[model samples]
Target: MRIVIAGGHGQIALRLERLLAGRGDEVAGIIRKAEQGGDLREVGAEPVVLDLESASVEEVAERLRGADAAVFAAGAGPGSGVTRKDTVDKGAAVLFADAAVRAGVRRFVIVSSMGADPEHRGDEVFDVYLRAKGEADAYVRAQDALDWTILRPGALTDDPGTGLVRLEAHTGRGSVPRDDVAAVLAELVDTPATTGLTLELISGSTPVSVAVRSVAGN
Candidate 1:
């Protein structure tokens, strides 16, 4: 399978790229900086330089051509303000879905946050972030042309992945390793039953493959 990942330089995206490439699948990562290309290449993923915030639908579609699936993993980093949250988190995700439709890619996986809801009441910045994620998820869910799954993981840790997780429509509040999140994403991309599902993930007793299969009814 050929997969395109937005936010190619992100920790989870890089982990997902390595996992897919290690399994002999072709992986391409979309990045904004040319310098990030070498890191992607080192992990066996082709790097395509395109800024999702400024790139047109046609431009993004051209990059997605012939790919089996697309993953929206982009985000405004920790230091970015609320405005960037709207542009990169919300706007970019919508753009990716549009381009996926234009390119005829039916499968899309979104890396969202736990607690992303329009009703979230928090500090100004956090509330804005949640709203952006909520809007992005809503947009993807509304797309009849795409078979999409949104994975919302809790606070991320750098711990090594245990390959175990609790995957459910709503798994409650918890934290999961970034590596484990990536592992779930790798499995989710090929799990058709996960389409239209918005799942929450966290570290748990169930192994990644089994958890995905169980939820997907495979």
Candidate 2:
């Protein structure tokens, strides 16, 4: 399978790239800076640099063409402000989804936060971030051309992955290792049955493959 991931330089995306490439799947990651290319190459993923915040739909679609799947893992870092939350979180997500449609790439996966809600109201940066993610998720869910699966993980931790998780429609709120999250994403990409499902992830007892297969009903 050929997979293209936006926000390719992200911690989770980097982990996912290694997993997919190690499995012999062709992998490409979209990055914002050329310097990040080498990092992607180190993980056996081809890096394509394009700023989602400014790239046009056609430009992005051109990059996505012929890919078996697309993953939206982009985000404005925690240091970013409210405006970027809208632009990167919501706007870029919508653009990427449209590009996937334009390119005829049907399988889409998105990384989202646990408390994300479009109706959420607050003036704080975190609140805005949630709303942005919620709005973007809403857009992806509405697209008919895409077989989209949204993964909303709880608090993300940098600790080592246990390869175990609680994968469900709602897993409440808990922290999961970035490694575990990437493992689940790799599983989700290959599990077509998971299409159209919005799942929650966090550390738990079930093994990664089993957790994913259970949700996918395989």
Which candidate number maximizes TM-score? 2
Clashing pairs in 2: none
Candidate 2, residue 76: the lDDT equals: 97
**TM-scores across all candidates?**
0.98, 0.99
lDDT of 1 by residue, 1-218 (tens): 99999999999999999999999999999999999999999988999999999999999999999999999999997989999999999999999999999999999999999999866777688889999999999999999999999999999999999998999998889999999999999999988789989999999999999999988988
By summed lDDT, the worst window of 10 consecutive residues in model 2 runs over: 110-119
Tens-place lDDT per residue, model 2, 129-185, is: 999999999999999999999999999999999999999999998999999999999
Question: What's the true lDDT of residue 164 in model 1?
Answer: 87
What are the lDDT scores of the predictions, listed in order? 0.95, 0.97
Provide C-alpha RMSD values for all models, in order.
0.8, 0.5
Cand. 2 TM to true fold = 0.99
**Candidate 2, position 173, lDDT:** 87
